[model samples]
Target: MSGDDSLRAVFARHRVRLLLAVVLLLLTMLAGVGLLGLSGGFLTAAALAGALGAGTTFNFFSPSAGIRALTFVRIVSRYFEKLVGHDATLRIARDLRVWFFRRALPLAPARLGGTRTGELLARLMSDIGEVDGLLVRAVGPLLALAGIALASIAVAAAIHWPAAVALLLLLLLIGIGVPLLAVHSGDAGEAERARHRTRLRTLAYEGLEGAADLAALDARDAWRARVDGAARQLAGDDHRRRGRLIAGNVLHSACAGLGLLAMLWLALSAFQDGRVTAPLAAALVFLTVALLEVAAGCGLAWQALQSARISAGRLQAIVEQPPSVSDPAHPRPVPASPATLSFEQVVFAWPGESRRVLDGIDLQIRPGERIAIGGDSGCGKTTLSALLLRLWDPQAGAVRWGGVDLREVAQDDWHRHVAWLPQGAPVFAGSIADNLRLGQPQADEARLWAVLEQVRLGDWARRQGGLSAWVGENGATMSAGQARRLAMARALLRDAPLMVLDEPTEGLDVDTAEALLVDMAAALGPRSLLMITHGHLPDGVVHRQYRLQRGRLLEVGGEAQG
Candidate 1:
């Protein structure tokens, strides 16, 4: 679907609310026009009646009552219009975020390889926010203009056809022509504005997020320069867009002035021909000016629409992006018991890469067995784990769980049978228990402490206020070793049959790394284990060890580097 269609789909959930807002806006505008027209006619008729003194009578009560009624309607409807319109817009904004997350989650680490977190953040917050403004800025104003135009033309016609024709032409020019011209004029910068805005947000977030590292590395100035450049470009885009918006507003104002002048000339000619009275002519002039004011807002609405369109396109790019891997249409369930993993002559290459990361590899890990594989940097040691986790299927061979092809099984079902501790696992900004509970949400206090104790974090947790203690963003509050251990604890909390530890002890000292590896091995009572690392393996931790060479695994007779 196109971006426009996608955006429509996003708002479809709140369509009823949006329709109600539009109705309120139309009623509000009509009331304003009526109030102005009645007040003008009443004052003029009263003045003329007073000039005739006791010889003439004016019906003050009825017109005065009508003015009061329109005044009340205008005020009340305008208030409700704002309330309903903003409520509906906020609802759509909330849902848009949820919708984007649902669509983007399945594509992670694979199809999302090219996307940065900051860029995604900007899309989620800023772009989606601009879309939310569509209801108030674009939709409401257009509906109001339409209602005001019809009412104003009818009133003008009652006075004189020439006056009515002039009002109609003016409304059409301001409502349609001027706004369309502004929209098209702003179109060139709308997309660029969105891009630069996202880029600015991305750079700002990156700079703030990595401020410490940049300062320590003496790279703060360089990063700031880039951020400044992004800011300048974004400012330029905004300037161009503002220029068009201002130009459109000026054009509409000029047209409204000219429209009033034309309406007055027509009214005067009608009065001279005895078709319109002096009081009625004055009323028509006031009504014409009010109508012009209502229609003039169309230019601003058009500019808002242009901005919203660009935001919709940015949001659509992620919501419509294809996942790197899709689950089978008809999937089988994984084994109920402990699953035995096997790789049969698996060969693989990353998407768009020519060199094979893994080639003709065969291996197995049965229930209650421990195995470790070592490899140099960039030798696809982690690639093997990704295939095992079904993050990406092998290009050549099938990875089986309990003799069944992994692809045939539902991804979620397969995930339930295994626990994986990826290298450099992130620690979310939350309570210690909150982060750990992600692995197993139902884990009780005793269970959490037990897992923490296993990873040597139990004492630290107690000292810091136990499970309720906060872990800063990405575990910034903890030492590197503590963060690694906390991540391991999270992985260990999962009661799965198979566990894959990819450099689980990274960031710890050699002695601590070895001890952590030994602790990890001892913690696996019945579950099968596959530890992938470039470091030395702990003695007796695994039943077998292998070395990953160029696209192949070579069996080693003894222990490798820790």
Candidate 2:
């Protein structure tokens, strides 16, 4: 999507709250100007009286009451404006995060494989920080400044046309012209900031991933140097941007000073010619300077606009990425009963690779059959299973379920009916029950225990506080074997008709692996199983075995072994 389109979408989502905030902000600005005008009138009235008469006849109560009331309104309006605007900005930030995450979900294990954990975290968090200024700093201030400028010009014109014209010209020069100049002048600084961000992200991710290695090798100094270098680059970029911002501010101040001088000259000329009263002239001059605050506010808001533009471009890139796998327009329902799986001359390849991973592979398995696929690493065993799960569509041929192409079924439906235990299953930082609940959100304690029993983890779980036991970050507090077994329990709890096991026992002890396999076969009786294994199969378990070699699947003994 284009940058403007993306920003419009964000605005559409936030427009209602933004409009309310802007309206309140305009009211606040109006009240502030009224307060300033009344105070100036009060001062001029006090100045006009002779010493004894000023002390006795100055109508202090009237102007004091008006000033007090207007000040109260301004304060209240300002408070609500900030409250509503900041709340709305936070809401937009949350929605953008959800939108980005949902869009990136289906592209995982392939599209997301190359991204580091730290970098992705930064994008989801820090990138959103940059975009927050769009609503918080840019929108409300610009709207308020526009209102103040127009109102000030109208008031000035009613008093003297020359003062009004000068004020408008100065506002245009500072608020519009200088900002455009700053944007052009700061382009190099912005580019440098982008580069600095990339370097920081890369270094942060590398340091996180290599923390253990760096500690072991006493290389903390080297990593610190790299981090410091990235930080210095970011600092330098910020310094340049600030320099440009200061230049813009200086230009704005100069224009405001010139406008004030013109307003003073016009007021004095009108006073000398007896075309205006002294109090009127004084009010116009004071109001003219007060309105300069509006111009400076707009200048600061413009910088926020520039930052938002940069962040919007980055966010748009992710949102506009097309999904590699999307549901069909007219999705077919998955079969109610368990169904046979068929791969007919299926061919597949990695995203950017020229060579296909699976070439002309044809296979069929009856319902409730247990099929074991054995192969060396990178020989298409996992690729075939991923295709069955519809992670990616085959470049040639089709994978069918119950005589219907898998692609015809809704993606959600297909996933719902099949449970996949991927290699090194992720263990979130939560209790054991929390981890298991991902597979079966509604599973009760009894049901959880049953699945744990099936996975041979029931006794162990009962000893570890049942389902409430904490599993530390990435299951770090648990051994590799325990984490794997916990993942197995989760898959068992899913209770889907088909189970795809990918290296389920890779890191388990021989006894533990055999026990898991035995229990899995018993629990999954009469359920279709497509298991990927690199070890010797248990005796009297798998009904058939297929070996993948050089991207081709071959029967073990020239017969269906079932």
Candidate 3:
């Protein structure tokens, strides 16, 4: 499907609200036009009556009452137009953000690994904001003006057909022609501005996040210069687009002036020929003027339209990328009974490379066993864990749980059976209980403490005021060892059958690391374990050890005895 197809679907979801906003906008503009036209006719007729010395016989109450009623309609419609339009815009913004996360999440790490976090944020925030304001900014104004133009032409026709014809020609030229020109000339500028804006946001976000590193490395000035360059480029593009918008407005005004003069000539000619009254001629000119004023906004409306399309396309591009791994068409349920995990004859390599990262790999972890694999950097240690996690399928052979190939079951199902602790596991800002509950949301207070003690953080928790104590953002309130144990407690709390810990003691001292493993080794009842780390483990941490060298697994300890 095309990039905009998803946008069309989202717009369709909120169609009713958008349509109501358009109707309200139309009412406001049309009522304003009608009020002005009626006022013009009443004052003109009143003056004429006075000129003819017949003022006492003229009735002013009906025209004046009509003007008051139209005035009230205009006021009320304008209020609701803003209200309903703003409401729809806000709702669209909320849905677009939710939609972005829903679609972009599934492609994480696999398809979107190459994309920067800041660039993705730019799309989610900046680009989506552009699309989210569509109803109030672009669609409503254009439709309301179109409605006024049509209604004014019809009213003029009822009074004088020739004047109606003149107004119609002018409305077409100014209304359609001006916006079309703005859209045509400003399309490229809008796209460029959006690109530069995204770049600027990305640069600023990255710079702020890495500010300390930038200063420490003495590269702060370089990053700041890049950010400033992006900002200047964005400003230049904005200036150009504004210039185009001004030119379109100028053309619209010229056309509007010519339209008024032509309408005046037709109205006067028809009045002289007795085709219409003097008040009617004046009212037609006033109506034409009002319609032209509304039509003048068409340039901005079309410009907004072009910008929204560009932003929508950018948001859609991220959502449209195909994931490297996907669930099978027919997935078999992962077995609930305890089973063995095995990789048989597995061979794999990184994409776009002929060198194999893993070759002729065969291994098995029986129920209730702990296995440790250590290797030099880039020896496919992490790749082996990733295969078990089923992030990517091996190019050859199969990974199986309970004799069922990993690819045979859904990825989510497999994930439910194994808990993982990545190296740089995040410590979110929340109470100790809150962070613990992330692994198992419904975990009770008792279970929270139990897991905390298992990872040797129970004493730390009590000292800090128990589970309710607030953890600062990114564990700023805690030491590296404390955060690592917190992550370990979270992982240990899961009800999964197998656990994978990638350097669970990362950033911790030897004493703390050994203490954590000693606690975990005793607390682990029957679940299997796979650890990828270079650290020396305390005895009983694992039942077996293997060192992977040059893409081959060599058992260094605990070789199975048949």
Candidate 4:
């Protein structure tokens, strides 16, 4: 489904609350009209009774009681309407963010890597907000507005037909025509405002993320200028959009005044001609007033609808992009046994490039074997691991697990057979245990401590108050070497047959890196290890070493010393 359809699906999940909000809004609007019309008629009747010497057949108590009832209904219904509507909108926003992640997370590095972080974030944070609030703030209220307009016209006709005709024409103009004008004039402005907003967010995000680089290069001033310019453009678009909105308000107000005068003229004529009582004629006028006042909000609601549509389309564009790779039509499961991984004559290139990154690559890792592959940056060592991980299929060959082609196996099941430690693995804002659980959610404390000890972080965890201690965002509280070890420990926690570690010893001192590899090699009991790095390894860490350069892998001599 398209993103717009998905957005509607999110709203549909809260349909009961949305419908209730509409009903409450309708009741609130109807009560307002009823209150005013009732008051107007009662006042006219009382004045007439006053001139008739105060002994007339006027039931003042009943009209007074009705006025109080409508007043209470309006206040209570509107309060609950706001409460339910806002609650539902918040729920939808929460669901939408989750849905966005579910769809976009799989595309990471392969598809979404080309996208700007700020632009992607703008869609998640800004665009989704526009869609999530539409049902509550605009669609429901507009529906209720229509309901009240129809009911008001019916009441006007019952009192006097000509007045109803006049009221209907004016109500249509106020409800439909004014909103159309607002949307027509403001469409371009709305789109421009959205672009400027996204641009501003992108600039702000880049400026902050690259603040250190900008400061070092003396370019912070230029980045700030770009942000300010984007902000000014956003502000300008907003001003123009609101200016169009004011035009709609003015048009509605004019129709309202004209509707009031027309109703009054018709009502007074009918009463003089003995067609309606003074009280009923007065009610018709007040009813027109109440309905038009409510209808005055239609322009803003319509504008919101247009803005939400633009935002939804933006969200849809991203969510609907085809993944670089897809699962097979009939994916088979990996065999539940000790699996041997092999790359057979694999040829590969990036998505939009002609140059091969892995050209006719071939390797094998038997169960419980330790193998290390080393290469310079951009030499496709990581690409080799990626193929084994099934992030992308080889253009010309097959990656096999226990003689079953990796493409034949479902990605999730294949992933379960291998544990990955990517170069840029994240340490999320969580406890050490929480971070470790990503690799092994059901791992016991003893196991967690064991893996931490394996990665040379056990003593550090103990000093930091144990597993439950807070780790700052992106492991901000820890040094680079500590965070790197934490990520390694996470991968180590997974009980997979194959472990792929890309530059595993990164950010550690020379002694620490070699020592960590030694412990990792010792800890590998019957598990095959494929470690990728350009750094020198301690002797006896791996059974063999291979070199990758210019898209070819060849058996190499010794460690690549830093």
Taking all chains together, each candidate's TM-score versus the true structure is 0.95, 0.91, 0.94, 0.92
Residues 1-562, model 4: lDDT tens digits: 5455475677788899989989999999999999999999999999999999856889889999999999999999999989988888898889989878877888876778788999998998889989888976689878998898788878888889898789888977888887897678566677788889999999999898889899999998888999999999998888888888898898778778877888889999999999999999999988887887788779889988999999988887787788767888999989875868888889999988999998888888888889999888998988888788877789998988889998887888788878899986899998999999999999999999999888788889999999999899889889877888888788878988889999988777898788778877877778899999999989999998999877888778643322
In terms of lDDT, model 2 sits at 0.81
* RMSD for each of the candidates: 2.9, 3.4, 2.9, 3.3
* Pairs in clash, predicted candidate 3: none
- By summed lDDT, the worst window of 10 consecutive residues in model 2 runs over 1-10
Report, for every candidate in turn, its global Cα lDDT versus the true structure.
0.85, 0.81, 0.87, 0.86
Model 1: how far residue 8 lies from native, Å: 2.6
Can you tell me which runs of candidate 3 are displaced by over 4 Å?
1-5, 55-57, 509-511, 557-562
Task: Name the top TM-score candidate.
Answer: 1
Clashing pairs in 1: 535-561, 535-562, 536-561, 536-562
Write model 1 residue lDDT over 1-562, tens digit each, in one string.
3354355777887888899899889888888877787788888888989898978878899989988898898889889989999999888888888788877888877777688888999999988988889989997788778877887788778768788888889889989988888777566688888888888899899889889899999999999899899999989988887788788889888888888888888888888989998778888888887787677678788888878888888888987887766788999878777767899999999888999999888888988989898989999999999899888989898999888999998888888888899888989999999999999999999999999988888999999998999989889789888888888888889988899999887777898888888888877789899999888876888988889988888879743222
Residue 75 in candidate 1 has what lDDT?
A: 89
Please count the clashing residue pairs in each candidate, in the order shown: 4, 0, 0, 0
Q: Give Cα distance to truth, residue 246, candidate 1, Å.
A: 1.0
Model 4 weakest lDDT span, ten residues long = 553-562
Ranking by lDDT: 3, 4, 1, 2
